[model samples]
Target: IDPGHGAQDAGAIGNGLLEKNINLEVALKLQSRLHQAGALTVMSRTSDTFDSLQTRVSKGAQASADIFISIHANANDNSGANGTETYYDTTYAAAHSVKLAQQVQPRMVSALGTKDRGVKTAGFYVIKYSRMPSILLETGFVTNPIDASILKSTAAKDRLASGIATGVSNYFDVK
Candidate 1:
């Protein structure tokens, strides 16, 4: 499942690209790729809209999904910062969340050739509220030039989807 955004909370923006749109696009692509890989998938949002954090968490819980991956793009004051990073809730003891991130980070970095912004822990709303193993992936710094270019490309987006699908398959041991 994917969390749209913080709701009424427009995430970061760069080069006239809104973070919300990037998140939705990546989430949709990830859903499609995962389905093609024979994994059942669901998304918290499929359009340009806002969803409350509680609603997203509730949806995941209701689905009783094995894993939840929240797709998002990063932004920073330092436009030079660029990389793909994943996050798991620090309070959660689920190793799968971290392991999933570990499995995907390399693929993202390799496919996009972006900086390797190592996995980190955060008390993100989505991760914190999710009952199942959950991860929030920051695909890249939308504020950065190089990263922005990649985000705008269909090829790069598809590559990101493939990497995410590969990671999920690895996590579930789905051949």
Candidate 2:
């Protein structure tokens, strides 16, 4: 499910790219691709509006989704740190989450040709609250010029979606 940041909270912003927008775009595309692959999908948000993190988690849980992935972009004050990273909840020992990250990270890096940031555990709200194997993927660094260009391109976005879909398919052991 996609978590759209709005109202008071603005996620990461750089090079006129907002994390919220990127999240929605990638989530929509991923949903479409997953549907094409015969996976049932649901989105927490379909527009540029705001919803609480709890609400997003509730929706996913209520749906009984097999996996929940929250899409996002990264930023840093340094403006030099750039890469793709997927995160899972530190408190959860879900093998599938790690497996999904392992499957997705290489594909994302291959498509973007960005730094391999590796996977890590974090107590992110979405990951923490999700019941199923969940991941929060930071697709790229918006503050970095090279990464920003890739993030802004439609081709790169499609590649990102396809890579993520491939990762999901791998995780589910679906051909």
Candidate 3:
């Protein structure tokens, strides 16, 4: 699990919420859920510390994780662009990434009751270099008031984490 940003790199900030904090909270929740389910999880950072993008990819690769999931909160200058989306790097592991995103996106929408921005292809460094079924999940746009509210709620974060964990289990047929 890779939480998007930390420390000096605070990522997106809006409505009194820091994207880095939200990312870590959700990532930790997901890590706990996966652990309780008997799945091994390797976290890029378990605290409010920074990890280089290359280091994040290295951790996933070094662990030989079956899937790499990067948790993030989105930001939009428009502030009206609100929704949940998942990203996969088509230049790398397109098919597996897409499969993971397909399983994850709708569940996120359903769990958070957020707009469905659907899955997209991007060349995010961590996901692109992971060499596995990798997905970078934008939980919601922090710049949007509605999304910011949802992202700030503990219940919503747990739901988001649960949804992602369920998606991962579904991807691996864990059960």
What is the TM-score (0 to 1) of candidate 2?
0.94
Every candidate's lDDT? 0.83, 0.86, 0.92
Compared with the true structure, model 1 gives a TM-score of: 0.93
**Better candidate number, 2 or 3, judged by TM-score:** 3
lDDT of 1 by residue, 33-54 (tens): 8889888887888876777888
Which predicted model would earn the best TM-score?
Answer: 3
User: For model 3, how does the per-residue alpha-carbon lDDT over 97-127 read when each residue is reduced to its tens digit?
Assistant: 8998999899999989999999998888998
Candidate 3 — which residues are off by over 4 angstroms? Answer: none
Model 1 regions more than 4 Å off: 6-8
Q: Candidates' TM-scores? A: 0.93, 0.94, 0.97
The residue pairs that clash in candidate 1, if any, are: none
In candidate 3, list every pair of residues with a backbone clash. none
Q: Residue 15: error of model 2 in Å?
A: 1.0
**lDDT (Cα) of model 2:** 0.86
Root-mean-square deviation of Cα positions for candidate 2 versus the true structure, in angstroms: 1.6
